[model samples]
Target: MTALGPEGHRKRLRERFLRSGLEGFHDHEVLELLLTFAIPRRDVKPAARALLERFQSLSAVLDATVQELTQVDGVGPHAALLLTLLPRLLERYHQDRWRTVTTLGSTRDAVRYLQGHLEAERKEIFCILALNSQNGLIAVERIQEGTVNRTAVFPRLVVEAALRHRATAVILAHNHPSGEPEPSAADRQLTRKLRRLLGDLDIAVHDHIILAGPRYYSFAERGEMD
Candidate 1:
């Protein structure tokens, strides 16, 4: 009897994936399956395990920058590039999901929309979701990106963008990489400042959302917005 060749083994992995959809596979196995798309003639199990060891999780492995990924043993530039492509594609896909999101009728709706675009981010970033007079979405624009814990958000600039879009309402959002969605004192202060400043311009501050990891805090939901 002939032992299973490398091709036969890969074929089995592919068949299992097609039948069961990764439900029974380990993390390294998933990476190995993905590597088969780009790597043709090599055993990718070691490379997949090395990537997980260096990055800790499949998500982290995909989110890693090219330079960071290259530091892993058995990961060359080509493999690293393939791994990094998932995040970029996901980012674009999420952006398209919200590209025509015109009506944010509920706090949950706003939170889910924000999560689709922001949850995977590794750093702090601020954005404005501008709404028309009828609370229809006009656009979602990133205002700034900052250090891990803080972003320099200028309320005046945000107001300017809202005005440019002729927005009558705004949903403010920022992410906390600390994995706790609780709003910090600084976050609360900034929210109050923007509410007052934009209120003065006859624009409504509908909500301020603090997203940390998978959790989210909505000021409107908490009765923090008047």
Candidate 2:
């Protein structure tokens, strides 16, 4: 039998992954394994270590821009693109999983979905979860991409999105990149004004949710949706 080499080591890593997943794999090992797919026939250990050193964490590595990632040694455009694509791929996976949730039965359900959709966002993006007459999820539409204040999120766009989705009810949602779930004065004002504008069209604003990392603020839960 041939003695173990880099290829053998990679094979062993794959076998180990097939056996127990990433349960005990170090961060660098995970990066090494991933880089193998992008950069074949190479010892990816140094590249993995370089990535960890440059980005500081596995999450940060996955979140890095292509330009930022390519700045690291041994990370070319293909590797950088693969790393940057991971987050969006994971989001698509979650959105597929979310399709199983036909109805958001409670505020918690809506919050959970919104958190998955918006929590990792670096910039503020306003979205609306359109609900059918029976509270079933019709669609999740991104209305605006920018700061989620009154000036940034116009009523006409929100109305257009809601009407386009044919939503009887909607749950307004946005993310706070600062990781503070507390609603700003502008947030409050926008919610009130939109509630009225949407109400005029006989559309109900069920809740306004602000996702801040792992935390969230719910206007409905806080008795502010009235």
Candidate 3:
């Protein structure tokens, strides 16, 4: 290929991506390719490098809020939106993929499914995986958010969510944005409370999984669910 300027460089990047899908690409190159879609007709290399330098990592750049992204030089609203959209898009993709799954019989199965749904969350999100008689997944519902503190309304919400799905069993789930898989005292209390409440309704609490990034804590694994 002949040497051209910025336009040629962008074209080469596109061609290389099509040929091999980011395997040999540098972090800045990946950002440059993504920025090209939002910022046409300009040399986006500097902008990409600047974003990486500011954010300190590729994942951090994608995870950054639009306001944070727009603070960087050469990053406009359009570019910022494009960058911020990637993680949500990925989350939706993973969610859609898991929605097709019919059964979640093991802790590993449940963990894999929930990680895709909750690992990206920046705050605590309490959710339930409603399951049918044969351990087939009915639906994953978000019951509460914020901290997992006990509230008078929390049990009612859990019951309502379980009843809403007609779930014979449920797997409780919540994310710990702090990236520690250990269950807090509140988490344990809530699990015990919910298990007892759901037991009266003839519903089983299969597990309570706390997600902290890639790590997780499982109440069932520790025999706490019993």
Candidate 4:
């Protein structure tokens, strides 16, 4: 058995990852691959292990706050920023894809669009999918972030943002960290409140989607919006 030096090891690892596309890689190897993008020249194996130990999983590490990422031994400001920005980049990609569709066809279409983009989140994020008069998606805005019990979503704020965007309709969405798609009593209450508030503004609240892991709950589909 031969041990490759740092540079040689990283070069081979990169080649292997490019060929195989993360299929059979270990957790440390995956972290190492991510770090290669962030650190470039540094030996990433130890750093990757440290990050895994600190955050438990790759998703958790990517989902961590900048402060939390900074606390890890090998993660500096630049690396933490890189990790934080990756999600935003993917979000922009999703938004771009959403823009390509001429109109939202059904409740399922709306949910499917969001599920592809937001199903893996570790924290609650409230997004407003703004639509034009023809029900075409105009923009998707992340209005707030919060813990499991509470999200800082305000009906007034949502209404104001919609008016600013000149949106005729809005679809509300939030992810459940606990991975249970069932809407809580609070979720129902919030939807009703938003519905009434938006009604006054002549902006229809199309749906309130609760994303729980792979599953999703739709207020409009279940007749909860009525």
Best by TM-score: 1
How would you encode candidate 1's per-residue C-alpha lDDT over 83-191 as one tens digit per residue? 8887767767877777777788998888878877787788899999999888898888999899888899988889899889888999999998777889988889999
Q: Which residue pairs show backbone clashes in model 4?
A: none
Report lDDT per candidate. Answer: 0.86, 0.87, 0.89, 0.82
- Winner by TM-score between candidate 4 and candidate 1: 1
| lDDT score for residue 188 of model 4 | 86
Cα error, residue 161 of model 3, in Å, equals 1.8
lDDT of 4 by residue, 97-151 (tens): 7657767878877887786567656668888888998999887788888986568
Runs of candidate 1 with Cα error greater than 4 angstroms are: 1-5
For the record, the alpha-carbon RMSD of candidate 1 to the native fold, in angstroms, is 2.2
**Candidate 3's TM-score:** 0.82
Estimate, for each residue in 1-226, the C-alpha lDDT of model 3 and write its tens digit: 6768888988999999999999999999999999999998899999999999998888789878999999999999999999888878878887887878999979999999998898777768889999999999999998877853322228889999999999999999988777788987888888889999999999999999988878999999998877
TM-score of each: 0.89, 0.80, 0.82, 0.73
In model 3, the runs with Cα more than 4 Å from the true position are 1-4, 24-26, 147-153, 222-226
Instruction: Report how far off residue 203 is in candidate 1 (Å).
Output: 1.3
Q: After superposition, how far is residue 191 of candidate 3 from its true place, in Å?
A: 1.9
- Candidate 3 at residue 169, lDDT? 98
Q: Report how far residue 109 has shifted in candidate 2, in Å.
A: 3.2
Candidate 2 structure quality by residue, lDDT tens digits, 129-169:
99999999999988888853322788898999999999999
Considering only N, C-alpha and C atoms within 3 Å, which residue pairs clash in candidate 2? none
Rank candidates, lDDT, best first.
Answer: 3, 2, 1, 4
Q: For candidate 1, what is the lDDT? A: 0.86
Ranking by TM-score: 1, 3, 2, 4
Residue-level lDDT for 122 in candidate 4: 64
